[model samples]
Target: MSTEISPESAFPGPRRVFQKLNEKPLRDDLIFYFAIVAVASVLFMMLPLLTGETAEIDGLHLIWFLVAGTLIVLVQGLITGAVALLAVSLVEHFFLLFVDVHREFEQTMKSTVYALSPLILFSWAVLLKIPFAGLLFLAWFCLSTFFGVRIFHEKSKDRAVFVALATGVVLAFYLHRAVGI
Candidate 1:
């Protein structure tokens, strides 16, 4: 057997990566998870700076304001993301049980994380302040979750769509509460 790895396999496209991650065993690298959270947090922090009006502040104060704002947003985003992940995963897990998809909670959590990759990774779009930008990312998240649940849980299309909708609703609630949008 060839030991060589194909480029596509080594560095898959986004959808493939999502599929591979959901198919694999649960990742133990806390750093990877933390990095995802950190990147998302930074993007979240940038939205206000990019889109909102700021008071006229001089150099030192501006630097201090940015530093402090970043710290607070990062901390809050990390905490809120972690809690939402667990809570949503638990809810999805139980929902699967009712639908007879017999998957483990860890598997459900992995699927949820990968499904959310679109939103977390491309959140910078929101910084542009375009109308309905957030909705685009939300739709992307829902589409990813639809496929993720189908592949990871071997769910039917109807069930997958239901799970995706439920996931979106939960995530929207979290975002609404967190971002006050």
Candidate 2:
């Protein structure tokens, strides 16, 4: 489709997200918050990857590693968070700029909640499995529902699921590269 959303018709959620963080240095709030989360996650994930089974460590080295790992985790968390926010924001931005929302915002939020239910359920199910890593699409679908609803306001159905899946793939690929996966 042409997807020519007028500034007025474009979704409101994305506009709000952008407006909230677009102040003072442009992306300070987003970068800082997400960085902390990413760093923690990265460090935690890295622990299982370390080898030498029960290798002894000096007090200083252990401390340093902890600090360093924490930093990386924070970095990753922040980046990922920013990317997540950006994904939704971009969709909203486009919609608001090109399309019109005939429905109300509250309705959109409800649909998003429903659509995201599956992803959350799947993540909880696959959190520590022997594989099926690709199942993350379930979570992405769930998340995208939230955004889709926010932007489209219950106008579209499964479209949000696809959007979420696409967002997940993009995020995973970029993160793998950024973290040297």
Give me the candidate number with maximum TM-score: 1
- lDDT for 95 in candidate 2 is 46
lDDT of 2: 0.47
Off by over 4 Å in 1: 1-19, 28-33, 48-52, 124-129, 169-181
lDDT by residue (tens digit), candidate 1, 1-181: 9899999878877656656666466664234565788888887767666766676888999999889988998998788778867876787776677678877777787777766655666666665555676877777778877777787887998998898888787778777633235
Our model 1 lands, by Cα RMSD against the true structure, at: 4.6
RMSD of each: 4.6, 12.8
TM-score of every model versus the real structure: 0.70, 0.42
TM-score of 2: 0.42
Q: Whole-model lDDT, candidate 1?
A: 0.73
Which portions of model 2 miss their true places by more than 4 Å? 1-46, 49-56, 91-99, 102-129, 139-152, 158-181
Q: Across residues 1-181, which tens digit of lDDT does each residue of candidate 2 receive? A: 7978887657565436433333334245334534445544664545454634433677789778767766776676556655555554454434433335565433333333333334323432343442544345544554655455444443354554454555455545654532233
